[model samples]
Target: MAATNQGGPSLLTRTTLIVVAVILVVFAFHALYVYTSERSEIIDDIELDVAESLKRLSKSLGPFIESYAVNEYESLVTTEAALKRHFAVIVEDFEMGEILGQPYYLFGQLRQGDGQYVDVQARDTSITEQLDQAFYAGSAPIIGSSGKVLGEVWVYASDDILVKKLDRALLEELFTVLVLAGILSLLLTAVLRRYFFNSILGIDAALKNSDQEGIPKAPVPSFRYRELAVLSNGINTMLDSIKGSRENLKIERRRLRNTIIGTRSGIWEWNVQTGETVFNERWAEILGYSLEELAPISIETWMTLAHPEDLQRSSELLDKHFRGELDYYECEARMRHKNGHWVWILDRGSVQSWDEHGRPLVMYGTHQDITERKQAEASLSMAAGVFRHAREGIVLTSAGGTILDVNSAFCTLTGYARSEAVNQNYEFMLASDHHNRDFRKQVLSSLENEGVWSGECWIPCRNGSVFPTLMTIAAVSNNDNEIEHYVTLFADISHLKQNEEQLRQIAHYDALTGLPNRLLLSERLRHAVSTTRRHGDVLAVVFMDLDGFKAINDTYGHASGDELLIVLARRMQTTLRECDTVARLGGDEFVVLLPELSSGTDCKPILTRLLAALSAPVDLAGHSVHVSASLGVTLYPQAQDIDADILLRQADIAMYQAKQRGKNQVRFFNGMDGSAFNSRLVPPASSDQSEKQLD
Candidate 1:
């Protein structure tokens, strides 16, 4: 039979070699078993002989020990021929001791004899220590005349002779077994090579001569063995199947290529081991480039174009796919475009081939441009974030005004939770008194015609309080221009309204007395004069200067003066009618407007009351202070048409006249001419008459 022409050893040769190796191992173990068994037996025989010699020595030592013949005992133990075969012999005298209140014998006297038949007094050596020095040892106790233990005799032996004899025998037996195994292995190889190896060599040659696609060129010849014949037939059958599969795979590849082209997806094939990559034209086009522009493409090219932040994640997914932890590698990463912008890509791949050791070799995948989709998603995320965190309260409603959604800001502003506010009418957010049905209809009409409405309105809260808000409602329309929904934004303007009121108070009122200042008083006076002309009534403009205010202010400080002024202002305000206006022009100077009067004499009672209120004593900073005002009165609609400033000048002239005359006296301005003023010393009126005049 011809030997196999294949490289390395054929199956028959390798099998025969393995059989020879196994046979050698078996025989070696068998030799070890026999050698160990015989060696153990020889050592056992030697130990048994030592035990018997110790027994005899113990018996002979007994009489000598009893008779106190120490020399005889040593001679008997040392001179024994059987004991000479042993490595050593020991003799120990028994010592008496008590343990746990019980008597016991202990080996005390130590005597040793070596294989040379020389005896030694080993007084420092213990019997147990002497026994440990021997390979094998045994002991027997000597019995005295009273049947008490007098001493112990021990014999120890070596296994040197046993080891030497067993090894000599085992070497001979192993040599014969090795020779036989070698001869038998040669015979088995010859038989197998003639039958099994030759048939397998023929099959191997046929397989080796196959085409590049690995399909056998010719069927394997039949073998003498039925199993080998069947194997040859199976190989032929597999070759035919492979040939058909190759054809089908070509068709499938074409179909898949067409499908990829139709879908406009970028196809990529990667030789993972070589770091080589192949990309379709679409792949370059997705990044706004031509395939020719991205020259010399490789795996490194992909890595260079991919976003640096996404590279680590892509590598992790690829590793997982390679390790079989994932069926496919999928990643969404940004790639650098030709225009210097980032383009989003959805990358998906699977390992297509592996090496014999199961490492990834080749992979195929598709790259899809997802930039638009990513932009849309980003826009949606931004809108959602705005809705969630914006400061202005936002509400979404259907066209019919049913609230559909409310944002966190709305929930916080209105004191209503999102779950509580949704599905209610939009009117629930409107203050009932401020936004009536007609107001709502007007808002709806504006939204319908103009598609938006915005103004300041009061918003009702869950706590039943209304807050001012700047609100805007816009109608969302479909493509047909029909209203679909409404989006309302409410900015709480309560703080703005409060700020306006504070600014008005600071600008138009006295800081100390809380009375209208000169700016407001002048405006009111002009309006009052205008009203008197329309109603055909008279109006009085009274100007007053405090009599003793400067002295009190100097004595008790400005704080005390301010307190007194505030108290006096309050008293005068209360004394006058509700239709009157009281204003503090400056330090201790004030103006009072009494409009809608029937006649000029109608002001006398009010003037009397004003003088009494101003003269009253005020408790200021633990000090009692009394102050009075020099009053001057001027009636509007004088003989000549005059403005508010002329009336004020006329009243000032009358106040100076009254002050010259006496403090706490009222002087009336003569409407006939500005040269002289009418002096009227009005008597103080009772509180009841003051009330009646005020009514």
Candidate 2:
């Protein structure tokens, strides 16, 4: 009771101190505002006065400068002192301040090139220092007859005069301010002591102690002043409300504690100044440690356990919160668990109070486990990296076949940009006519049954080129096992298709002449034989060997011989009907199959043409060489029942007979008699020709 009754500064004394502080603040603010306003007004007036003086001086001097321009300063005073005398009268006419008084206005003219005073009739040499102190100055370029800037005419007003005027005005205002402040402070002090001090003390006494019910034990009476009565009544009302708030706060705190306990999240409080930390049992459990085992924990315990990679960033966020750059601190970081594995924690906190200098005094926050979330994020990042960098083209589409995203490989394969492909139907970029309704249905069915479809397709490119591709289409499902999207992976097979065609050509044709070789020739002969037998028509085989070809090859080289063979082969093909076949059976030997013929006689005309084409002179390396053919003709469906191979052999035998009968002649084999039925010769050229035959 004695301690409670100990005297301290009285209410009246504290109130007086507050009033004095308020008065001083008001005085400072008023002084600053008055000084700034008055200075601004005076500066504006001085600038305007300087501008007016320049206008007047320019008007007075314009006639003189123009005259000097025309007359070349002949009638003007050239000496500086004489010029200053002439300008002094003009300056006096403008009602400028007295010369002996404080310098208010100064005028001068200076040569533009040298910065020296111009030798005008009225240059004022003594006013140079005053002009240097000018706060406001104006100048007009004095141009000469040649349109060059000869000098500048200037007028100025010094700030010294303006400053002196402001000082006198501010002194007068300061006296007025002192009188007003004194009167206001006296009135405020008297009013507070009479009307507010007693009432406020009475309310303070009533609130000093409370009964078990938390109601004020002593009642405060109303004051004589209306404002004092209102203040006393407001304190009583606030005390009653405080009792109800305290009960509600208790219930709310219990509910909050239960919510925190149900969540099983760690709670913590940190004393920033003392470097101490308090943690609940759940905080220790999050890291697989018990409260007793981690009992003597401080902030350093958390720092040491935090993963080194994460501690720096977490600390930065906490500093931001402390410095008020952020409203709160929230960071996800890892800590070393008791089991030696890193555990992720989401730490969140905010300053609860600050010291006098605004440093954080206390911080409160919680921790939550987020290891699973970080793991999932890492997995997602890896999948995204694969999609971006994979070699095979991959396209992701919506379930409805709308193109959603494509990897770089897909863009390269289809020649479509990502912007052009997205939001468009997948068929717009990669699908060909082969992707018909049936194909789509098959894909959908496979997705429904097996969740994937792999097949070959022809995909189209942006340039209207189509190429084969091996594609795999898969269905992507959500957690509920419903199709969310479709993934398509494909590889371009155009090069593979080209390689296959090349291999087929290599297997079936002569590489030198690009004609059907023996293998392809046999196949064609069999097909011709079958067709001729079925139609009851004749098929003839003419086998030809070039005459003097080996002699020409030995003389002109194999390269020339090969060229002659290619030329002759092409000529033979042009001479025969399109249905007929010409094939190279080996060096200098060829077989022609003529099908759908009426008789062996129908082949005579073709044979004659082949001999004529082969006998023509060929130009090889600028040398004219001539080669001839020894032809043997045979017919299919003979009475002896000869097959294609037998027929070939029979024609070959007849060819040997033709070679014996003198080269460059045709011999037809008569199957009924098995002899050379007929022999014909290509008519010889004129005697003047240099063509000669090999022995």
Candidate 3:
């Protein structure tokens, strides 16, 4: 082979002589081709040329128009100026054309007739696309007092100008081709006579005389024709093609390297020769190493960063791949991050190619960032675990009150475990037997709109024990306004409920005998009066005052009186039916409100039984205390539309009448019913009764 080229031509005087001759011929052909192709194209560009020429002409004319407008001339075509001071604005830019005459194409500055000479309307815009056929509106549109629209101008460039331009281009191209061909033909004959003929003949003689080397033919041929020029040019072009191919190969390699690095995945290259490894900074950073450590880097160093649990398996996979038993190695394992924590990575490596001898040479690969994926999976698992081990009663339902998720605490609270509650409607726990239906609707409302709600609810336990609970329900929603779940947290309030009921009873009843006290009795009295008034029913208020109970307390002490009160309270309780209201009005006083009565006649029997019970007395702490009460009765709705207070007072006054007749007698409050006259309800002293009473 004639010294086959590897990268570039060797520096030799003989080769230099030949290359110069070839370059001269190539330039000759290049000039020839340029002349041949561009001649007609330049000729065809006449229209564009005219437009450009016009633009230059218009630019030169701009200053004169500006000056005429500034002088405020009434007519610029008719006016001449010394224009010495204003010479600067009037100076020609050369490209601007002279203003043409009347009936102009665009802005007409010239008046068509006489006095109607158009005031100048010189345009501010340069190269207005609006004027394809050129036009001029004169200087009036320009500034200053003398400015006037002088005249208008318009014209299309003639086709004759374009034809003349084409003719000139053809002459120039012919001149260029002739000049190029004559210079090339003369230079080639001289170089061929001086260089390739003598150079090749001398090289052949030297090679033949040395006689030690193989029989080699000369690359340059013996020639006098232009074929030698063609041949040399062809060889130079071939050399150029090789140079381009090598440059393209280098570019491809650079692009491949960049693509690997830019992918954000950690790229790595294993060089089996030097036992040195090159890794992308990302790869090293991902594995807790710096790029500066590359020279000292090895696969062994990387293995140390793998998680202990995963290291052995990763090693095994690598071993198998290296032994040629496997084509690739892949495993998910933890690699320490630059921050020193192990992050999970999917390590994959492929056998991209082998060397000529079939020996493993280079491996190219990358590691992907999977930290987020791993964390998301772990978060999901953790959430599931928390749900499994939760302690507070948690029941997650749909917005519609259907149970979706339940925890052990919920089961413990509702006496239903996860297995039983998950598939059932949450309303099942509402205890349809006890809780109102309207409350369930409220719970639904809270879950759908407010995202939270809480109140007392009677939830049925598994054993059918219904309990009141302070429940808080929350709505879970996504980014969109759609409800995902309803979470209910309930704290058992059964004890509070029981205690509250006991408190209610203690508030209204006398703790000593479990009988209605004054507060409850007054309430009942009012209710009785209202009912009697509304229904035309008869109701009575009977008041009784214990006569001897204080004496019993005075002798046996208050302890014994309290006991006596209890005994008498029980006796009075049995004296009347459940429909009647009896209340202890402090001290030794008691009152009864009887409803649904026919009249005071109905209360009469009740009063008689009460008095007998009180008179019978009871044994208290070994002392039999003889206790009697003065009883009085009053009718409702018969006198003055009697309210609770008036009826009770009247009954009390009647009781005083009984006291006057000596204790234990039951009296009816009709009128004339006071014994001590201290009762506010006492009827006015009878004229026949009081005057005689005083006497």
Ordered list by lDDT, greatest first: 1, 2, 3
In model 3, the worst 10-residue window by lDDT is 81-90
Q: Candidates 1 and 2: which is better by lDDT?
A: 1
Name the best candidate (by TM-score): 1
Clash totals in order: 0, 6, 33
Clashing pairs in 2: 83-121, 83-122, 83-123, 84-122, 84-123, 87-122
lDDT of 2 by residue, 1-695 (tens): 11344377787888787887788778878887988898999889867765555555445444545443423222232232133322211122121223325332223333322333453233343444434544666655544455644334455444665688789878877887788878888899988866777667776677666576556766566777788788778877887787689899999999997898789999999999998999888899989999899868999889989988899999889888887899989999999999999999999989989989999999999999999998998889988898999989999999888989999998898898888889988665435775687776776688779989898888887888888999998999999998899999998888999999999999899999999999999999999999998999999988889988998899999999999999999999899999999999999999999999998778777876777788888899999888887888888888866688998998898888778876677788876677775643443452122333421
List residue ranges in candidate 3 displaced over 4 A.
Answer: 1-392, 411-420, 432-434, 449-451, 463-465, 493-507, 623-625, 671-695
TM-score of 1: 0.42
TM-score for each candidate, following the candidate numbering: 0.42, 0.41, 0.41
lDDT by residue for model 1 (425-539), tens = 8877764577788888888789888999999889888888888999999999999989899999989989899999999999999999999999999899989989999999999
Candidate 3, residues 347-383: lDDT per residue as tens digits? 7886666788766677766788788898998878977
Stretches of model 1 off by over 4 angstroms after superposition:
1-385, 417-424, 428-442, 675-695
Instruction: Indicate whether candidate 2 or candidate 3 has the larger lDDT.
Output: 2
